[model samples]
Target: MVDLDPEYVAARGVLLDALEALADHREAIVLVGAQAVYLQTVPLPGYQPYTTDADLAINPSLLGPRPGLEEAMRRAGFRLKDEDTGHPEPGIWEARIRVAQRRDDLVVPVDLIVPEAVAPPGGRRGARLAGEHGRRAARRATGLEGALVDHSLIEVGALDEGDSRRTTVNVAGLAALLVAKLHKIGDRADRPDRLTDKDAGDVLRLFMSATSQDMTQRLIDLLEDARSAGATRAAIDRLDPLFGTPRSLGTQMAVRALAGVLDPATVQATCRTFAAQVLAALGGAG
Candidate 1:
């Protein structure tokens, strides 16, 4: 609920309008990616110097199958970006929607992600929310109609400092997004191919930023166990860069262990030699 510029107000309106309109025929839509992160209040949502575009998750069935939806976005004033399809699986596709740019300290691009490649969240997590948060979000819920309803940018205003709802929205939103990311991982893994670097990086970024400390410790432990259990070299390689960088000692050790698996001979020899030197100075390998 950040206050937006007057000029960009109508642009945000238009983007909301399109999604609301699309939602009419679609079962459900969840905003995802950077926009979702910002909505979730991850430590660095708006921390980025500048960003363009908002990403949303929508079911393809809601869009009436393939290229028609892409044409729809074009009609709505979005310049769809065409990139080389990184994954060649039959059901994956993406369309980027850029509605407007704002002029403040820096220009930020607002993008709308068409949910083609990735599926939205499902089940009780997706079904409904609970407590005061559930009540408030429901009142604010645009359903499909609410999303289409226009409000002046000036009217939206900055989120009230006293309000707790923003945090609630962000926390719930982030939790759901993490589930989606995990799902995407499984989907890609089940295919003939492995998860892409982009997918892995996205998960790591979210994990470091949004997860609670206890959860973070658990992830570190899980990665350590995965390394010991003989996980794939690529998996261990991905975890290596996270260790000993500038974080906690526990994080450093986790990275060191994974690095060992990725380069066993070098890592083992170096670590063992280092350990032996220390042991000799004091007494042994215990």
Candidate 2:
């Protein structure tokens, strides 16, 4: 078993605390982004360990009152961030919460991202959830129902093996995490400045860590499941171009973004192999 690093352990603790605080709204939330990646891959080899934030995709309809959510976070030791001046703003639907940990000076950020309006066809912009309509769109495209089945229940902050009070959080399924990562990387061509090296590196690590065979099977399974669950054909089609032969500009950007993560030769080989697997899976789906 892979050992959980101190940073991930602390982050998981914070995430668990947040989940416990929001237990009343658990059904409406789906953990996503880097934190979800960490949770799903923690037991696997080559799991990258650099994120200090937890991101959750929340249904706007269930978010209820902002004040109540804020109060819950505050009670769990998180302070709401009033402003974010960072480039490519987080948008209006996203909220950041910070907590001071006793072990270090680093403040952990937990981001709650409500799905905004769906982007136009072939748009490569960020996933910003606008209002209730956007939330519905997100649920449809992401096959939210499938996520509920593929999730793993993790017990956090347990004092002992039998600790009954240990908090449990439902992590996003691996397939959901994979789709989200691919979407982010696929959108890199449209927002190169905002899509940083970390994003590319994460995608690379995700592909490299899982064998092409395993990934191919997983994608096929996810696609089949999504289709059966009434996910839009458009949503499934969007993923095809990303796996196109010769690779798209976004794929190149992802490769270029991995300069220091791995040797150039290895990165190229891994990308090629992974892309081939994806294309094959797409063909099989067809």
TM-score of every candidate: 0.35, 0.62
Counting clashing residue pairs in each candidate, in order, gives 13, 4
Most accurate candidate by TM-score: 2
Residue-level lDDT for 63 in candidate 1: 40
Q: Model 1, 179: alpha-carbon shift in Å? A: 8.6
lDDT of 2: 0.53
Q: Residue 240 of model 1: what lDDT?
A: 27
**Number of the top lDDT candidate:** 2
Listed per candidate, the RMSD to the true structure in angstroms reads: 15.1, 6.8
- Compared with the true structure, all predictions reach lDDT values of 0.33, 0.53
Model 1 lDDT per residue over 191-230, tens place? 6256443333343344545434333332333324421112
Residue runs of model 2 more than 4 Å from their true location after superposition = 1-10, 42-48, 59-68, 83-107, 115-149, 156-166, 209-261
